[model samples]
Target: MKILILGAGQVGSSLAKYLGSDDENDITIIDKDEANLSSLQRHLDIKTVCGHASYPNILEEAGIKEMDMVIAVTKSDEGNMLACQMAHTLYQVDKKVARVRTAEYLHRKELFSDSAIPIDFIITPEGLVTDYIKRVVEEPGAEQVFEFENGLVQLVETRAYAGTPIVGHPIKELHEHLPKIHMRIVSLYRNGKAIPAYGDTVIKDGDRVYFVTKKSSVSKVLKEFRRLDKAYRNIIIAGGGHIGLNLAKHLEKNHRVRIIELDKERVIEIAE
Candidate 1:
C-alpha cells in the first residue's frame, strides 16, 4: 500500500518505523522540521519531505495525488484537519485519517462529513485510551475487554478460578449451566499455551478464558466465572487533563465521579 504521513513527531516517526519495516507498504512522510525528517530518513526507507504538513505545494511534493491514504498528525489540530480535507477534496484520496485533539471539533461530528471536512477517520489518542480504561473499570473482573457493534457485544477475558461454575466441566456444559443465556468460549489459555476450546474441551481451573456474549449478559456470565467485583459508583481521578476529563464525562452519567486538580483554570474548564 502507498501511504502519505504528515508530521514527523513521535506519532509520525513511530508510524513510519512500523510501516517502513513492512516491504508491502510505501510510506512518504512530511514535516516542517528538517532535523526530524533527516533522522527518520536515516533509519527508515521512507521518503521524507520537509515543509509545513498542511501546505498544498508540500502535499503535492509528497505525492498525495498518487498515494493510497493520507494520515495527518501535526501538532496543530487545524493543520491536521485541513491536510485531510485537502487530501480528499483535491487529491481524491480514498482514505483520510487525521489525529484530531480538539474536543470542540470532535463534539461536532458533522464537521467531518464529506460535505464538510471529508475525513474518513479521526484518531484521538487520549480519547481512545480513555474509553479503553473506562471499559476495564466498567467490566470488573475482566482481565481485558474488547467492544464491538457499538458496545452491543463484548469479548471478555477472565480467569477461571477453582470453585467457579464450569471450571471442571466441558465447554458444552456452559450452555447447560445457564440454559437461557447464550455464551461462547472462543479461546482458553492454560500454562502459557493456547488450549483449543471445543465442545468437549474441559475448562480447567487457572485457565485464562476468553468468551463472547451480549453486553447485557456480561455481568451475569461473569458470575459463572468467579465472584464479581462491586460496581464502581464513586470514582476519584487525579488530574483533569484530556484523558481524565473525557473519562469523567463518560462515567459521570452512571458513576459519582470527582476530579482533583491543582490547576484552577483547568478546574474551571472542567466545570464548563
Candidate 2:
C-alpha cells in the first residue's frame, strides 16, 4: 500500500514510524519543516516532502495521485481539511482521513461529505482521548480497555496485584473463582516478555494480564485480578484545554469536577 501522510508533527511522525515498519506499506510524509523531514528520514525508510501540504503541486510532488490512502494530520484543522478535499477532487484519492480538532467545524456534519469536503474519515484526537479516559475511569482496575463486536465484547489489560484473588493461581482456577462470570485470558506479559496463557500457567504479581470478556461483565472480571477502587467522586483537572474541558463536561453529570488553568483568561472562559 502507498500511503501519503501530510504534516510531520508528533501524530504524523508517529504514524509514519508505525506504517513504515510494515513491509507492504510505502509511506511518504509531507511537512513544511526541513529539519523535521531530515530527522524523520534518518529514522525511517520513508520519503519526505517539505512544502504546503494542501497545495496541488505539493500533493503531486508527494505522489498523491498514485496513493492508496491519504492522511492529513496537520496542526491546523483547515489545512488538514483542505488537503483531504484536494486529494479527493484533484487526485481522486480513494481513502481520505483528516484530524479535525475544532468542534465548530466538526459539529457541522454537512461540511464532510462526497459533495462537500469529501473527507472519508475524521479523527478527533481530543474526543478519542476523552473517551479513553472515561473507559479507564469506568473500569476501576484496568490499565487499558478496548471494545469490539459492537460493544458486546471487550479486551482489557490490567496488572495482577498481590492482593488479587486470582494472583498466584492457575489460569484454569478462574472458572472456580468466578463460576458465573465468563472470561478468557488471552495473553500475559512479565517484565516486558510474552508468556503463554496456558490453562496451567499461574498468574503472578506484576504480570500484565490481557483478557477478553463481555463488556457488561468487565467490572466483575477486573475484580478478580486487582482490588477494586472506590467509585470516583471529586476530580481536579490541571488544564482547561480541549481535552480537560471535554473530560470535565463528561464527568460533571456523574462526578464533582473542577478545572484549573494557568491562563486566567482561559480559566474565566471555562468557568462561564
Candidate 3:
C-alpha cells in the first residue's frame, strides 16, 4: 500500500515509523518543518515532503495521484479536512483519513461523505477521551473500561479488595456467585506482574482483576472483584471546551454536573 500522510507531528512520525518498516507499504509524509522530515528520513525508509499539508501543489509534489491512502493529521482541523478533500477530489484516492478535533465539524458528520469533504474516516481525539472518562466514572470500581461488539460486550478492570465477597475466592466461584450473569475472568495481576488466571486461580487483595461480560451486567460483574467505590453523585468539570462540555452533558443525566469556564463569553454561550 502506498500511503501519503499529511503533517509531521507525533502521529505522522509514529505512523511512518510503523508503516515504513513494512515491505508492502510505501509511505510518504508531508510537513511544514524540514527538521521533522529530516529526522524521519534518517531513521525510516519513508519519503518526506516539506510544505503546508492542505496545499494543492504540496499534494501534487508528494505524489497524491499514486497513493492508495491519504492520512491528514495536521494541527489545523481545516488543513486536515482540506487535504483529505483534495486527495479525494483531484486524485480520486481510495481512502482518505483525517483527524478533526473541532466539535462543530464533528457535530455535522454528514458533511464528510460523498463529494462534500470526501473523508473516509474522521478521528475525533477529544470525543474518544470524553467517552473513555465517562465510562470510567459510570462504572464504579472499574479502573478502565472498553466496549466491544458495538457496546453489547465490555472489558473492565478493577482491584480486588479484602472486603469483597469473591476477593479471597477461586476464579470459578464468580460464576457460582452470580449464576444468572454471563461473565468471564480474563486475567489477573498481582504485585505488578501477571498471575496464572486458571479456573482455580485465587483472587487476592490488592490484585488487579480483568473481566468481560455484557454491558448490562458490567456493574454486577465488577462487584465480584471489589465494590468499595461509592457511586459518584456530584461532579464538577473545569473549562467550557469541547471535551469538558461533552463530558458534563453526558454526566448531568443522573449526577449534579457543573462546569467552570474561565472565558465568560464562552460560558454564556454554552449556558444558552
Candidate 4:
C-alpha cells in the first residue's frame, strides 16, 4: 500500500518508524520543517516531502493522487481537513484518515460518519485517551474496555476480587449460574500465555478474566455476578501541554479535571 502521511512531528515520526518499515507498504511523509524532514530522513527509508501540506500543489507534488491511503496528522485541524478534502475530492484516495483536535468536530460526530465524506477514520488521540482514563477511573478495578461498533459489542476486563462469589469456584459454574446470559470467556491471560477457558478452568484468586458480551447486558451480568461496583469520581491529571489541554477541555464539562505542570509559562497560560 502507498501511504501518504502529513506532518512530521512526534506522531508522524513514530508512525514513519513503525509503518514505513513494513516490507509490503510504501510510506511517504510531508512536513513544512526541513529540520524535521532531515531527522526523519536519517532514520527511515520512506520518501519525505518538505513543504506546506495544506496547499493542494504540495500534496499533488507528493503524488497524493496515486496514494492508497492519505493520513493527515498536522497540528491544525483546519489544515488536516483541507488536505484530506483535497485528497478525497481531487485525488480520489481509497482511504483517508485525519487527526482532529477541535472539540466541535468531535462533538458533532455525525460529520465524520462514513456517508459524509472520503474520511475512513478519525483518530482523536486526546479524546481516546480521555475516554480511556474515564473508564479506568470510573471502574478502577477494570484494566481495559474494548468496545466494538459504537458500543454495540463490548469486551470488559475485570479482576477477581477477594471474597467474590466466584473466587473459589471453577469457570464451568458461570454457565450454570447465568444460563440466560449470552456471554463468553473468549480467552484468559495467565503468565503471559492466552489459554482457552473450559469447564475445568478453576477461578483462582487474583486471576484476570476477559469477558465478551453484548453492550446492553453488561450491567445486568455484572449485577447478577455481584461484580458491579461504582467507579471512582476523583481524577488528577499532571500536565497542561497540548495533550493535557485537549484532555482537560473534554473532561472539564463532566469531570473534575485538575492539571499540574512544571512550566511557569504554561501554568500561567492554563490559569488564564
Of 3 and 4, the candidate ahead on TM-score is 3
TM-score of each: 0.91, 0.85, 0.91, 0.80
Prediction-by-prediction clash tally:
0, 0, 0, 1
Candidate 3 residue spans exceeding 4 A from truth: 260-272
Instruction: Write the residue-wise lDDT of candidate 2 on 136-189 in tens digits.
Output: 877878889988987789899999989788888999999998898889999999
Q: Model 1 over residues 105-153: C-alpha lDDT tens digits?
A: 8999889899999898898999888988899889888888989999999
- Give the lDDT of residue 142 in candidate 1: 88
List lDDT for all candidates, in order. Answer: 0.90, 0.92, 0.89, 0.78
Which candidate number maximizes lDDT?
A: 2
| Model 2 Cα shift for residue 182 (angstroms) | 1.8
Whole-model alpha-carbon lDDT for candidate 3: 0.89
- Whole-model lDDT, candidate 1? 0.90
The CA lDDT at 171 in model 2 is: 93
Query: What is the per-residue lDDT of model 3 for residues 147-185, given as tens digits with 9 covering 90 to 100?
Result: 999988999999888888898889989889999998887
Candidate 1's C-alpha runs over 4 A off are none
lDDT of 4 at 25: 86
